[model samples]
Target: MRVGSRRAPSAPFPGLLSSAQFAALAAEYRRACGFEICACDSDGKLRRGGAERPSEGRSVSDLRKHAVSEALRWGEPSVLSDGIEGVLWAIPVCQNQKLLGGLVVTVTRLRRPSKAGALDQRVVSACRVLLELGTRYNLVNAPLLSERRETARREQEKAEALHLMKEGTFDTIRSIYLREEPALIAAIRRGERSAARHAINRVLTAIYMLGQSRIELLKSLALELVVTMTRTAVQAGGNPENILGLNYQSLSRLADISDQEDLAGWLCRMLESLIDAIESNSRLPGSSQLARAVKYVEEHLAEALPREEVARAAGLSPSHFSHLMKARMGCTFTQLLTRMRLERARSLLVHTDAELAHVAAACGFTDQSYFTRVFRKTHRLTPSEFRRAKRPIRNASAPKSQTSARLYKPGAAVRC
Candidate 1:
């Protein structure tokens, strides 16, 4: 996450994907979908001698640039067209929302069939998913790359002295430590207290082996792990300034820790503190809290639930939870609850033979008339009409056009 002021590399991101890998992916696209992939910079300038180059016509060039710009702006794949030429797909190569560049592909002569357009979209979407996978791979593996570069020289010297001491001991321990590092950071990000603690123990066991009989070495290793944990904690919604200040205090205490057992306990305690910090920040509007609130509401939809009761389930005050619902969910608690109830009602109407009154009560509606009113207002169809339209037809010859009427309103801002 640290930004350096050194001269930037020629590629959009060094070590993220090599040119060979990029070309291979492009080739795969060509072989599979007859689409040519081109590499473009953040400015939408096609990379020279990288992948397949698109036509340098002004319109094609402008379309590609605009596609890249849109993808970067949204931090996702986007499609663009100049109307004359066929569709252009831009899959941005971004990390942490920082736009580096992107891959541009074009099907200049798309078929008039809707299936062709859908197939192209599907292929491009798959490519975007793969690139995102690569981005995450870099995020998880970058630290290992840097560690290897830093230890290569030390490892060479250790090899020269191997005959005079234990062989493969340091390598085995170091490998185990590196293997636990990704798991530890992942668990920390997810706020899994037990899993993080266990991974830290495994990492400490490896560090202890490497620093056997050397307390200073063990302390330094522990400090290194602390630094990694703090970075991860910050990424997991912990306050940066608070975490940094806490880390400073933890480092100051590390100097007095000379016993291996004491150091292990201290690190475990430190991990717990990081977990607490993450949980403390749960009051802030976030997907985890929103999902938890929605899940609680859904699980208790039949009950006469109040906002205060739901807020307690989400571990937030009613007022704060109201604010969170507005900020992250773009709806009030009542609106979300009503929407969820209607959704459940729709399901029960189509999937079960429940009476309208029973369905209304089961979905927390006070009465059947009220449920029908709200459902018709939101969906533009009465609950009975919706059931008739959506109910599976037993006749195999049923015309598809019979079910063409839209049953649910897609324009609603909130569904949960």
Candidate 2:
């Protein structure tokens, strides 16, 4: 009788040994090399061996954790010895610059293996051979695995970046970014070129150090600085067209920057240009009370914003502050507040997946119902509809129309 063809059991890592195969390999190594063996993944989770209870006064679990952590931290083979645990060796297993996991071996203290000893050399060679085989297997049958490893590495890099930003090295930089805005604006308005230049230099230096000379990260931070400069220019009475054009130009050229120093110099020049324009503008000097009111409104956008409270904060009577606000901003205090809150709401809606009720409360609306009514009246669509429309599918062939245009146009007023 003819027999049908049979398929072999597939290994999770393909040509690499399966768990049972690895167990048999580990047993062989233990017998040949006279050492206890265990394995762990890149995240320090145990994978094989070390199943027996710990010897008296020795915790097997803690030893395994330490082994994995050491291997990952050093990114190389490391050996640790203790009176009770003998000699513990941690060997990192990596492929294509990606850390896969580690192999740990416990050697007897009686042998006392040194770095150049025959036993140590043999064990290291064996571990390297196993990792090499695993690397070849991954390359041949698991290209997707390489992509996943790269994504993990990138996430780790971002986490490190955030940690560094919070550390002492970058803390002063963050303070300048957040707290020196008013000072920078005032310097620009007063045409204090040296003071403005000093402020800009401090901020750019901080960004440079924070980005660690990485071109992509530096460009990301430079673009954020551009946004801040644009807003400050607008508040300083610079022509909107000039300020926004500079912003657009800077952003468009970010990808072309290769050197951190060049990027910093370019940004400083652009900021200075914006400040010059602001100083040269024919508009009368902005009222200090109006500036104070704007600052107060920005800081208190989430709270109840009564006109009397806002006027008091600006050091003006309610009626006079209301008149000046209309003359300066071309809108009433309530209208301006609503516009600011809705601007914040629009930003959150586009960038986050927050619930509508949460968005309402965050933008200072008393309730979701009121937020919905105002949002619909102003934008001609509900919040949900607006969000859905904004998230367009990538690479889809859709023709643009007036609907998209209206969604992005300025002067889309919110009636208070």
What C-alpha lDDT do the candidate models reach, one value each? 0.66, 0.65
Write model 1 residue lDDT over 56-87, tens digit each, in one string. 45456566678867654444556665476466
Evaluate candidate 2 by giving its C-alpha RMSD to the native, one decimal: 25.5
TM per prediction = 0.34, 0.29
Residue-pair clashes per candidate: 0, 0
Q: 274-361, model 2: which lDDT tens digit per residue? A: 9767856736434776777777877788877888778767655576678888887788997899888888788667666799999998
Clashes of 1: 0
Quote model 1's TM-score.
0.34
| Deviation from native of the Cα of residue 227 in model 2, angstroms | 0.4
